[model samples]
Target: MATTEAGIAPRPDQAGLTPLLEVEDLRVEFRTRDGVAKAVNGVSYTLHEGETLAVLGESGSGKSVTAQAIMGILDTPPGFVTGGSVRFRGQDLLALPDDERRAYRGRSIAMIFQDALSALNPVFPVGWQIAEMYRVHEGMSKKDAKNRAIELMEQVHIPAARERAGDYPHQFSGGMRQRIMIAMAIALDPDVLIADEPTTALDVTVQAQIMQLLADLQRERNMGLILITHDLGVVADVADKIEVMYSGRIMEQAPVHDIYASPAHPYTKGLLESIPRVDLKGQELSAIKGLPPNLTNIPAGCEFRPRCPYARDICKEQRPALAEVVPGRFSACHFAQEVLDGDIEPAQQ
Candidate 1:
């Protein structure tokens, strides 16, 4: 069997068969001039080996914030993780010392940001940028690192990788730049990969290619993947589970099929209905009404109540807790059963 770089085979946590990564009751806040903005609130999820968890939400819904917190890259001073624990293989990463925590980054956990151009250095050749990963983490010799970078570029399907290794970041197209980012991210062979909007600016064809490449890599490595995006269409085929977030809170959590089949929360239902359907060509696309609440001064009770068509008086007065609505499915809506059963129309009727 193939082993990790450390010569140890990928194995479950000997302690208790613990998950690869677990975030429990995570809370993140931003201290801006306006006030404290709660970007992530009580977010919790588990990622096991070979599983893909897609965090689906609109802009400013706190999907990216949660991923930033997991990767320990949240901007300090402005962004702070106030509470909760980030456990990897049964150890709380949040509790580790700063220097020790830094060791996990790149080596054990890696991330690919949405903007590849901004993430890569414009001054250096793409190969040197990718080789930096090996040189810094593994302390490999310069020649070996450069050779490895070329190999990685080829693995990601970049044409003439050896010849193009010396090219600057600006020399590549958007999709190729993204592929370079992927090569850098996977260089250390991390056990968990967090891809934050990997296909943001790519065309439809490129988006599908990037998603497929990620899926293939994940299968080959048995790595747990956290795919963060606002596009429901992108994750429909690849994601194993879904977390629908709104107003900095998770509205629903279920298997991919369960969520696509029937959403249990009003917010989730609104999002699903908004996805453009080919069968309904030329018809107006449905959209969730109103904007995401201001995090600094979020409304009392359910944050989604303002936009929820099925919202009742109780919804405005009582904050619904994320509770299990059925076996292996959870929803933070008071009328989850009614919504799932199609008893209540969403943003219509």
Candidate 2:
């Protein structure tokens, strides 16, 4: 198996500095009426400070689940963390006691959910919610917390922050509510920020604003950012590195420029081809054929072989481990070399 200097899977930590967050062989599952749905399987990655790693995959590819697992928010009874080690700042988060994990949730590591309206409580004033984060983490007095909350709102460019701070969730626009969510996320200056489709409910204009806001905040704080989004365009400007996931596994991972210029996995190529481009105007956009496989009964070898145009018998018989075909680029495919040689292309949909 390909290994980093740490004797683990190939990760960003191999070079030198320690990663802010390291997810090793992380797996999650859900017990549904049908069967056990393996959402994430052996997914691993490392996030360094001052870097944005975008996790790209269609819905249900376990991108969000992996983030939730790191944040200790996966609902039980149905969903459960099967196996993994979420190491943050040299400590294994999964192994930490509940109290310790709770302390880490919003203080050391924070998450911004996709829906700001639902994520923010409707009953309480938005300011109260933001203040509660500070109160809980820092044990600040109510007055001090409220003051800090207004400062945070101002920091996120929420207009009339002092006045709007007392307003409930419904009083704010979608974009403004998302800004409030961001303010709450950065209130504690967490070392890591996991944004799971942070711009999902907003317009293109608002999305751009939010992405820029996140980039600015990361730069100011030098925080590690994990942006989970299916939209390739969303990460183009923000991400330093990108991980392309499919059917509960990472198909390809590399620096953002490398993945866009020369994707070495069929799944990555398919995703890029699926993006609507100005150059492809009037032409039907390309899309990968077939739905993602059911994780309960995933294909024996290559999970993407059924939809992969370049698949061969070997791809069906033996699972391909992710390998570094080029410096700092990894792809899990039997024909990775062929992909690098530009011999394969996305199947014209």
Candidate 3:
């Protein structure tokens, strides 16, 4: 079995230079009529100051679920954090009181949901919605909050910020709406920012702009950023580290360039191959063979064995541990050495 690295992420409670956020042995489950679906299983990683960690995975691979859990937004009826802890600046968030957690939601940590239109209130003007953050958190007067909202709008490069501040959610284009979401998320300049698929539906140019804007904001504030998305193509230049998750567990973790150059896990290898390339135009785009497994009934042992081309008897009989494969990389594949040795084909995603 894979051994966890004592896996203690730094928190603020500790002395100096502690990590901004650390998640260790975290598990989340959802109850349904059928059974409990394990959404996150023993997932762990650390984010330092001004660092960006990009989580890449399939739609149901627990990317967003884990983020929701961190933000304290998961609905408890169906969802529960079964194990481990989420520590921010050394404070155990899971142990915080409900009211205290609510207080931390936007001021210390913030999230930009997948949909902006739904995230923003249709009845209220954009500025009112943004100002609400200040009104509620800092007790800013309405006029003062609205002026701050316009400043945020202008900072995000929204056109005619003062005028558009009065516009409703329906008035802005998709890119502009997304900017508005970013503006609100950063209003308090939270120490950590979690953007769940910030670019959902927009033209390629707009997507580039949004990502660039986020990068600039991170740089300007020196904030730790957690970018949760399925788009492997977008994170290459932005993220300092990459964590590839599958079937509620982390399959691979490494620095961004190392992961792109040579992934130690087969699933990460497959995901990399699946990226569309201009040079590979006219060739069929690669895809992982099957749909992600039903979490309620994840396969025994290695969850990815059935889909992996290099699966062996050992793979089927025993689950691989997410052990250190190299100095700075970790992979949950028994044959990680074989993969690094070029036994697996690169174009096999």
Candidate 4:
């Protein structure tokens, strides 16, 4: 693993690097005909150099939306980042102008989109897409950038990358396409890499390969990797920390081991129980009951109360603040301590 010392955002003109990236009270909403849907609500987390923060949640739980907001890619017509602070090395990216933010995006921070095939243009050769980043950012010659692209492809373990550099996105396999996305993400050596479901749509073997590739890359560059996915199995080995989200709010945050050992939130516990376990190989997998709250008309207090197993009147009366239940462990559950103390378990299935 690379050094974990305080990091500064890298700059061509500046000296010093700090791996600190903090998102404070991030709130995002979408204005639809139905009503304003809150996608992310007061979400906050800190990422550092060489750290892997796995964001776990079900679909529409705001995992991808949060990443979109950080990457400055949210659609403005309907999607709005109402309030937030995306700070990198002490600079809030939300405060920067469009030009500066654009510069920082691909240079200082890059994202590997979930859908690789769609992310790459159908007409352009994959290598050209990867090399375009260099042409735009580094102003490299086409031939030189193409060479760099091949090297990146090979770095991600794509075979015969020099020969396949001219291949289109559709030409490669699903796993290879994802590797291409990873190549482009790491092409600029960004300080942080937000991989939103990189392993989505892949078979089990391919998923392992992609996860290993990401782990290797993060170790190589000491990059802060924010892995957004619902796959608990992948997060177990690759992530240093885990942040569990539900109803657009962070339900729990802790080291990966701690999360697996003793979850402090009922939602998190249910998720853990849902994962197929080795010891109980044949047992049925549990599922969280009830659906996530509708963002536009979220319940009075805790959004998860409708689905939570241990919910009580107190839960209905007041919203639970994300509080620290133990050193380095945070949970938004009002009974976080009770859950951690083995006082509660998700009512089975």
Candidate 5:
């Protein structure tokens, strides 16, 4: 496994190379009866081989929508990729034809969704579903596919893989179903793995186990991983970098330690403070007040201005671009330095 002096793995940017996945000025919109919902607005990021980038945000923060756009699975008509390019290894995924994109989807890029129960077909046997992945990608015979499926099941630590392979989705518990999803995702050993809240509905113990599995797999294959999650605690352990998003925009992007130790944006700080910690015994958790702005009618200035405690006249009147306030750390706040200097703590009460 790759480790730094801090005992953490090296991030993509730290390794010095072009990114495996580059999203530039990505924009997505949904035409609703109410209005145009700007789900992803000029968002940009890069994922390099062997790096884990966590997109952190609350519900409706456009985290999942961004992933769907990269996967080329966004439902059209209501949804559209309005602008920007999702470049993977110098190829624009958006510009690719349907057949070309399909070939890349599983063979080069894979996703493990939040709900395995819904993602997995109820009627199909879990083994058949896993075997189909190999058959489709490699054109293996039925016997070979079945054997590969058993091996994958065993690799994921599914109990009695041969016996459980024929069981229906309902027969497996929630954690087991998620393991099956992981098996299918890695069956082709894709270069990029987009995991959308992979630990949802799992207990703390199972959650850790799943995370460890992903970490181990990433090291083994040196693949880029985009982990979309709302839980700060989850990302704290796995992500090399963290991007805090609010109202479809990144509030802050920094190395994991920089984010936890000195968040430059108020929104990022609020999120870090909100997470319950063992160190702060008997202290009330600090929660960010107010709700995220409606995407259809976001605030004129900063999208987070309405809920931001340090909102100034400028903050209320003009939007702040995601600017690098310090080397290797970006923040979309005018007073990013002040926030990092501890001059802007959570407003009392």
Candidate 6:
């Protein structure tokens, strides 16, 4: 599991710009008193250097769980990754010992959590918290670590970073706190960054700022970024590709422009329709009917069948494999082509 001093390399078979990370047939489940809930089922994707992959879905669609599994941060008592592999630079992470895998965190891969307040240690000074990474991981002197923390604070655009380094987590505003979180995550210059709802409660202007900062940092570091969120509009400009998930499965995956222009799955189409559009001003916003299926007891065939307007007997009788509907686009729906062409009206509710 030891990587070279030059760091990780691409898979042997891959030619040209190789992917930085790959997840194949990943499955995770949570064992609860009610039942075993399948959280992530056969989730797979590739992330290349400097690429932005956005995972979009409603809440409970397993976006966060998949990220957690990849990071090796899932709580094991109730949750476990039951199948598949997560490869970083062609190395299978699941096969690594726990200590070896832990070393990769922060140094090779880092995460920006949704809530900065909860993620940060409130009792400690922000600088001390950030400096801890360098001091603990790199064995730097106290003075050097503190100085590095201030440098990172400034890098993230916090004004008066030297002075603010002594400030506690509660002293900074929400946006500034989030920037500190980002600063801490990138301290080791990780090759891959997974941001789980980085702009959850921020205003539109601040949301744009956070996203821009992430993009700028990604470009500067040439890092592969995975942005997980429920809002499609937030990722419209930043994401290179999209994976729309439902009931723990990716219902559709396509280039960002393609998904916006023509979604191939009914579930994806419904998600697009649900977004508020300027042209539809004053008109009631469309919404997907019913709700996501309960993971413990998903429907027999298509998990989305109950809420899908395009559902038919075939949909109820058999599960559709996620297959390429076009050259690059993939969808998990039996009537993918018809749906993409808008050939059939949604069954009347």
What would the per-residue lDDT of candidate 1 be over residues 5-87, giving only the tens digit for each residue?
32232222234445889999999999999999999999999887777889998888999999999999999989999999999
Query: So what's the TM-score on candidate 1?
Result: 0.94
Q: Give the clashing residue pairs of candidate 3, or none.
A: 2-321, 11-89, 11-90, 12-89, 12-90
| TM-score pick, better of 1 and 5 | 5
| Cα lDDT of model 4 by residue, 34-68, tens digit | 99999999999988777788999999799999999
Q: In model 5, what lDDT does residue 258 have?
A: 90
Superposed by TM-score, candidate 6 places the C-alpha of residue 329 at a distance from the truth, in angstroms, of 0.7
lDDT, candidate 6, 203-303, per-residue tens: 88988889999989987787889999988788797888888989999999888888899999998888888878899999998888898889999899998
lDDT of 2: 0.89
Candidate 6: stretches off by over 4 Å: 1-15
How far does residue 50 in candidate 2 sit from its true spot (Å)?
A: 0.4
Please identify model 1 stretches exceeding 4 Å from their true place. Answer: 1-16, 345-349
lDDT of each residue in 1-349, candidate 3, tens digit only: 1111222332222345577789999999999899999999989988877778999988889999999999999999799999999998789999999998888888888999778989899999999999999999999999999999999999999989998899999999999999999999999989889999998677889999999999899877877899998888888968888889999999999888888899899899888888888999999988878878899999888999888888877887899989988878899999897786668553343
Q: Write the per-residue lDDT of candidate 2 for residues 185-278, one digit (tens) a residue.
A: 9998898999999998899998989999998898778788999998888888788899999888898999898899989999898878888889
Residues 135-223 of candidate 5 have per-residue lDDT tens digits of: 88889998899999999999999999999999999999888999999999999989999999999789999998999988888887888
**lDDT-superior candidate, 3 or 6:** 6
RMSD values for the candidates in order, in angstroms, are 3.6, 4.7, 5.4, 4.3, 2.9, 3.5
lDDT of 6 at 172: 94
The 10 consecutive residues of candidate 4 with the worst lDDT sum are 6-15
Give the clashing pairs for model 6.
none
TM-score of each: 0.94, 0.94, 0.92, 0.93, 0.94, 0.94
